[model samples]
Structure formats: C-alpha cells, structure tokens
Target: MQAPSMWRHTLTFFPQFLAALKERAESDSTVTVIGASDGRLVVPLVAAGYRVIAIERDPIALHGGEVQLPGDRTGHAMGLIDRLKREGFYDRVQVVEDDFLETGPATTRCDAVWTSCSWHYSANHHQPLSEFVNRMQRLVRPGGLFGAEFMMPITQRHHMLEHYTSPERLRQYFIGDWDVLLTLRTNEFSEQAHVGQLQDHTHRMGLLLAARASTPS
Candidate 1:
C-alpha cells in the first residue's frame, strides 16, 4: 500500500520492524501502533494481512482535514479512517481515538508494538520518557516485538530532558525480559518539509528493536 504523499519519503525503521514481525508473528497477528498518524504504517501492516490496533488522538489525522503545505499551499489530507476504507483494509484494523498514555492495555495482548518519533513531541514531554517507553512495552505479550524510532538530543532544551535520548540510554529500559535485537543511530541529517513543519529541518534519530522473552514451558 502506498503511504500518503507527505509521508512517502520520510526516514523510519519501519522496514526493519516489519522484517522482525514477519519472522516472529503469524499472518493474522495483531500489531499495535501508538501515535499512528494517518495510518502511514498501519495501512501497510493491514495490507500485509496483520490485524492492526491503531491508537491515535489527533482528530484531524484520524478523521481528515485541511493542512498547510510547504509552498504556502493548502491541501486536504485524507484521514486514516478514510484511507483504510479506500484501501479496503478497514476491516483488518481497529482504530482507537484516544491519548495512548491515558488508555489501558489492549484487551488482548499484541504480537508487536511500534511508535515512531512520538515521545519527542512537546505534548508528550509532560510525562517522563520512561513512562512512555514502559507503557508501550507493557502492551506486547511474551515473545512479541517492541520497536521505536525516536529523536536524539540536538538542542539545549532537548539535552535538559530525558525524552530526547540515545540508543544506549534507551537500552537500559529493555535490560530484563527483553532481547535488544538491534540499535542504530544517525548523525544530524536534513529532512524535507512535511505537513507540520513547513521548512527543511535537521535531526539526529535512533532506533531500538527488542523482543520480549517467552514464557517458560
């Protein structure tokens, strides 16, 4: 499935996460996406035959709305719900419109959980970074995968907070009952403008992929 135009060229470790999912999960395995903005990753998971539990709080992203483009252009974004319907993957997804931290765990355990550049947002800074990571980890069942790609510290404000973290720092959270499969970090790199940020920006990012240990036989 094609991602929305605005999200098409973004940098994400989702491909790596997908590879882990394929190796570890069944075709019908349920994957939960925290901060599932506009189904960028959700649609593809559903298209690949996985059931998706999409948790997103933004109404504009989940339901569609006008957006400001890079060239002072105005565009109407096709929200996640509509995109799923258009692609005929709605039935494979359960969209939850709520603040992920405010909600409890899924009624059933998920085969995997993922979030991309989510915790760095100012809106999420009120909570400790550990809280966000811990919450996401809780949703994954034993033997399930947990993946996250996040912003690394680049500014004074970022340095002051634990939210803008590094791969090494994040690994501390996965020390027990989890296997740190892969960890990668990038130097500051330029990124093209997208819906929210209208100008080119530079960022340093990190990715972490871990698998929960299975229950003892």
Candidate 2:
C-alpha cells in the first residue's frame, strides 16, 4: 500500500517497536497512540492492520488548518482526520481529540500503546512525569506492549523538569509486572524546525520498550 503523507516523521525506534508489536501482539490488536499528530505513526499501524486509538489535543492537528513550517514559513496541514480518510483507514481508528493526561485512561485496554517525544512539551509540564507515564501504562492490558521515545534533557530548562528524562531514569517505571525489552539513547542531534518549533534545534532523545507480564510476577 502507498504511504500517506504525514505532517511529521516518526522516531528512529518506531520500526523496532512495530516489529516488536508484530511479534508480540495479535494481528487484529488495538494500539493506542498518544499525541497522534497527523497520523505519523497511526497510519502505519492501521495500514499494517492494527486498530488505532489516536489521542491528540490540537484542533489544527486533528482538522485541516494553516500551520507554521520550518525556516519561519507557513503552510497548510491536512491533519490527522483527513489523512486517515485519504488512506482509507478511517474506520480502523478511533480519534480522541483531547489531552492524553486529562483524558485519563482509554475506556478499553489496548494491546499496545506508544508515544513519541510528547511529554517534554511545556504545555504538558503541569502534570508530573509519573502521572503521564502511569496513565499510559494503565491503558495497556496484561501482555500488552508499551513504547515511548522521549526527549532527554538538552536545554537548561529541560534539565529543570523531570519530564525531559533518560532511558535509565525511565526504566524505574517498568519494574514489577512490566518487563523492559529495550532501551536506547541518542547523542544530541540537529533537526530542522517544524510546526510548534520554528528554528533548527538540537535534542537528545531516549527510547524505552516494555511488555507487561501476562501473569502477576
């Protein structure tokens, strides 16, 4: 199948997470994507035959609207809803237009849940990092997969907040019934600006993939 145009690309670890999901989850599994901006990851999962619960808060990200681009440019965003429809994967996704932390747990437990560089945003800093993570963890049922690639501290402000975390720091949450499968971190890298950020920026990122033990440990 042809790939849908996405507003943003996914994290480096996404393919690994997808492979892990395929290996660990049923083909018809339900996958929840937190901060599902314009179907970057959602489209791939649905195209691969997994049902998606896409939770995002920004209206412009959900419905088509004008947006700011790199190098101080302006452009139009086709948005997640339109992208899903264009890809013929609309029926396979459930769009939740709300803040993930505020929305709390999804009504149903998902077979897998993923988030990419979402929690470090200043808008999300009001909540504790533990709250954001705990809620995401609770959304996955036993034997489910949990994947997250997040921004590690780069700027001074980022270092001030626990949300800008490292794989080592994040691993503390995966103990007990959750088995951490992988942990990777990137050296500081430069990315051209887009959307929320307008100038070229450098960032360090971390990835964590864990699976919930099927039975109590």
lDDT string for model 1 (1-217, tens) is 5437457678988899999899999999999999998988898899899999999998888998899989999988878999888999888899999998788765688999999899999889878889999999889999999999999999898899888999999988997799999998899999999888899998999999999999733
Most accurate candidate by TM-score = 1
Clashing residue pairs, backbone N/CA/C < 3 A, model 1: none
TM-score of each: 0.95, 0.94
Question: What lDDT tens digits, residue by residue, belong to model 2 across residues 77-148?
Answer: 778998888888999999999988787446679999999888988899889999999999999999999999
Model 2 clash tally, residue pairs = 0
lDDT of each: 0.90, 0.87
- How far is 47's C-alpha from truth in model 2 (Å)? 0.7
